[model samples]
Target: FDEDYLDPDSDINKMGRALALGGELDDFTASLKDTFTTPGSQWQYVSIDTHVIGMVVRGATGRSVTDLLSEKIITPMGLEHAPYYVTDGAGVAFVLGGLNLTTRDYARMGQMFLQNGRYNGQQIVPADWIAASTAPSAPTAEGQIGYGYQWWIPQGATEGEFMARGVYGQYIYINRADGVVIATNAADRKFREAGVSDQNIAIFRQISAALGGT
Candidate 1:
């Protein structure tokens, strides 16, 4: 990985176009420093670490993460449409936040997690990986919520309650015990407001409780 190559400032099309241009992992790591503090030290809620995971997959197998995901996860489920990775100017798959799928497709992903990585009688993602990914890795300043690997756990959530949240109020709340997956896509007037997030969480919990999950 060429640190210089990954530096967002080094290129005009850092996240936009440079990412598609595959390069050494070091370059990606170097670019990542600007994205967050050391893992577990601080919570930034940024997309760089997810991208790093993609890089890790690529480095370990010498294959694009998109291909691996398709072979291992997507194809097995026979999803009507395959998810595609967005590329940066460099042509690297935008692992951070480039995934695009319909609400039903997103619900399928949540359902897979709800099943602990098993989908349609086949084990797609490892159960252990799912557990580790949903487990809290760090606490934000609010101390109410915690972040796991690319997933979010609400404060005081029961062991089985978790969520996959995205920007612009996109969310997938899963209650394993209740067998419910609440998927929502919204355009909140206020972005990143704690109150808004808290309200949404409250509503989700209400639904879960009404369904006898809580």
Candidate 2:
């Protein structure tokens, strides 16, 4: 299913609510079976997965994902001015890619991950979550890229390098070994073209090298 086709009032969306409410395997498995037979067999970048993950977070905690993220991630990082998701046409927080934040705030998040989920002497996100979320778990052929949980691992990054990227040229490139992070936001005319990726990667590499990476 096209991630963009997600309807806030659709059955899947309802399933997401159920999953968020601790509905158990009967809820999650039912949803998955309706979607696919086996996990990781087919590789598709569906935004609904992250939305469902948000649901899971909401269900696990008694708070909304937005609030939880703010309490745990944003506030601690001092991103009081971060641009969160406005209501979609359907009045739901578009969890797929609806978050907006300043370049410096995004860089702070990248730096947090580069520091292994520790920020300001506090462990915000679990280190295991950071590791697993940034590690490539599926194949991305046909000029596409590898996928982690909701992150992207470019082809030739070092063992501990990955990125948090979004559509229309939103990026936070994190290089842990070199202690470098490049945060960028752009309004490009041709967003999905190879030129954008190549240019961004080139810039990231140049910046990393300039930082004196071995």
Candidate 3:
């Protein structure tokens, strides 16, 4: 069966809910097996492969995502509030969208990116990783939004203009030219509407301009 796991109506979504509720890794793998095997062209736009990322990180470092993140990023950044993730019953951190962080913490991350991965005189994320991840590397159509490694490069954006976007209008916008970072959290049910993403970017640009990032 050609299972569109990205589809809300698909069986994978049901399995995803179970995964969210502390299901096992084997269950998630089974869900994938029940679906299509090969990735389609749309794979460029969406991929639910974060489980593999968690596995790789653990295998490579022999540490959990929460531990690595806390020791490497959170603690070094000196965040006012510690971030957390929804985990499986096995305590495997959800590598995709399970992270819960305060808006201030989000901005701190954006600022770190803006400063080439340095925060409070400490190197959080590697500078090369920041540059490579934020670069326009995705095969997107011209004048459309572009995807970098887990980051978004808006249409018409120059170098150093990128965002970390999340569900329900959550955003950490960085404008390096004018030294601006904007963090926002929202409960937007209409986020999938046409032009919503563009409008959000426009609003962020307006905010950036207002903050002397022009």
TM-score of candidate 1 relative to the true fold: 0.79
| Number of clashing pairs per prediction, in order | 18, 1, 0
User: Distance (Å) between predicted and true CA of 186, model 3?
Assistant: 1.3
Rank candidates, lDDT, best first.
Answer: 3, 1, 2
TM-score of decoy 3: 0.87
Please provide TM-scores, in order, for all candidate models, with all chains considered together: 0.79, 0.76, 0.87
lDDT per residue (tens digit) for residues 13-118 in model 1 = 3544444455533364565544334646765655555666787888899997778778888888877677766665455666766688778888898999999999
Worst 10 residues of 1 by lDDT: 1-10
lDDT of 2 by residue, 106-182 (tens): 88889899999999889988999999989887777755677888888887778778898776677899888778889
lDDT of 2: 0.73
Q: Count steric clashes of candidate 3.
A: 0
Tens digits of per-residue lDDT for model 3, 55-152: 78888999888999899988999999878787777777777667888988888989999999999997888999999999988777777888888899
Q: Rank order by TM-score, top first?
A: 3, 1, 2
**Top lDDT hit:** 3
Sliding window of 10 residues with minimal summed lDDT for model 3? 34-43
lDDT of each model, Cα atoms only? 0.74, 0.73, 0.80
